[model samples]
Target: MCIAYLLMARKNSFLWLLLLSLICTLEYIVYMGAKPAGDFSASAIHIDMLQQVFGSSRASISLVRSYKRSFNGFVAKLTEEEMQQMKGMDGVVSIFPNEKKQLHTRGVLDSGIWPESDSFDDEGFGPPPSKWIGTCQGFSNFTCNNKIIGAKYYRSSGQFRQEDFQSPRDSEGHGTHTASTAAGGLVSMASLMGFGLGTARGGVPSARIAVYKICWSDGCFGADILAAFDDAIADGIQLPLELFHGNEKTDTNISFCCNDGPVLASITNFSPWSLSVAASTIDRDFFTKVQLGDSNVFEGVSINTFELNDMYPLIYGGDARILQQVLVEQI
Candidate 1:
């Protein structure tokens, strides 16, 4: 049986940047011929082919990223005329714009991450699976442990912001949240400002995490996403994704969707190869004790991290506003 996989970026998604034909220069990803035979480096071959097409000096400028890991392709900045020329070249498969895609808060892919987070502890866990052949690509002040087996970042079609870290250390907490949710170790008594306090853990607490920093301050570019995908496939991670479109009720095999908002037709996954997961609500309620001067105590839903040493005057919001106006008039 023959199987074909198509990689497409969603509309307005961070995955790609759509450029108009009227633009003098635009970014595009070109998929070359099949993988080279034994001992042949796909990257080297891609560079050579690029040099042949765009000349030695221009090739260096035009070439943005090389996809050699599992897929045989490369991303380049080319004009419309040059794109046409590349289309007629030998061993060229297909070419398309590096469009952008929208991003959701619940999924993975974000700015760099914090390795020191407690959820990323690698205690009592065995070494990574023997099939894992990935490596940790860390820079100064950044390192990966057994819990985070691999780390890599990509930026091919866009420029990084001033605050953007080139390394895989997440400045924002989104990457950490998604990674921890995927494979973070169990963290006891975890809560946000003493809310929902309980034993916190990920779906697969024992599983290791491999951080791939594709999204940046601006957004996640298609070329970068493709580069990360290629590297991931080469790094021994298998993402058997296939796209399908139909009614969910009729299509029983369409199993994958994100932890998106509770809305109609919000399930994002359509492929049968992917998995369906939902973030269920817990039964826990957080309440703090409120003690009055009369020694009367009551429990209210709130987050109280600090102790109240003394009782304070409590008044309605409207009354407090009126009092503030009166005091301002006297002043």
Candidate 2:
């Protein structure tokens, strides 16, 4: 079977030249899949592939840069035998030589904790490609302009609010916030509830937007998420940057509805921090206390209402004084 892969030349030209002079001169571009058959994430696929092929984590440190947003492929450097072995892997689609090409053209491509009034009119600011079909100003009916490339919403379950079913338009403010921060047009003399009064513009005022309303206030189901991913890939979404939470094990245990069966959204232990954080309703708070050799003390966020009347002995590192052999905790 013919497997697919994407290979890219390293960014630094000098490094490439050094390799050509001292190391192997031959270079090949390889394309490999990241997304799995089920609603499983490309992250999960990458974790599985790395463990199966590489002997250690360091092996992947400088070699592979998996494109998570694209969810379909990654760029890596491999020899003929390694490339041939990749083709036999379960998720491997195809592998071939890199078709090198270059073009000289003037082109461009961001806001705030999301600052809305920022100027995107500077260099590298422009509309998206005309072929893009994303939406703008909240999901609406058939809306794609030069500035707004594409728009779509995925709804697998009818359990959402009645209004949500009407249009992919953002019923919740989150979708709008995300869009505006990335590509909202410059609005002169803008303010938030009469605060931060000034020009309110997105990071890239000229950049066009493609709205994909996949989440909701209540919650997003697994099937709907998969549907959204399918549509996004088909509609030419290049990358996704959503974060994933961590647990003791790499496997996330989160399940996704797939055509064949339900698959777990397994990720590695070293996955990056997750952006999708939710607040908890616990009553307890944590605090930290530290003591220095200079008799200086540091206190952290103290949530407990009670105070201790007794004082405890402390120790400091590098003081070379074990008078009472007192131990000190710096946490």
Top candidate, metric TM-score? 1
Report model 2's TM-score to 2 decimal places. Answer: 0.36
lDDT of 1: 0.69
Q: RMSD for all candidates, in order, please.
A: 10.7, 21.4
List candidate 2 segments past 4 Å from native.
Answer: 1-142, 163-165, 240-331
User: What C-alpha lDDT do the candidate models reach, one value each?
Assistant: 0.69, 0.44
Error of 2 at 99 (Å): 42
Give per-residue CA lDDT, model 2, range 1-331, as digits (tens). Answer: 1112212223446445334322331233334544345665654555556446544442354234344443455444454555566678875666554332121110111000111213322245456765554444343344444455555554443456664544555455555565666566766788555444677666767665554555555544333343345455566665332312233344333221222212454221123433222223446446657566576889886554455556666547566455434453322
C-alpha TM-score for every candidate: 0.64, 0.36
The residue ranges of model 1 lying beyond 4 angstroms of the native Cα positions read 1-23, 32-57, 84-94, 105-109, 241-331
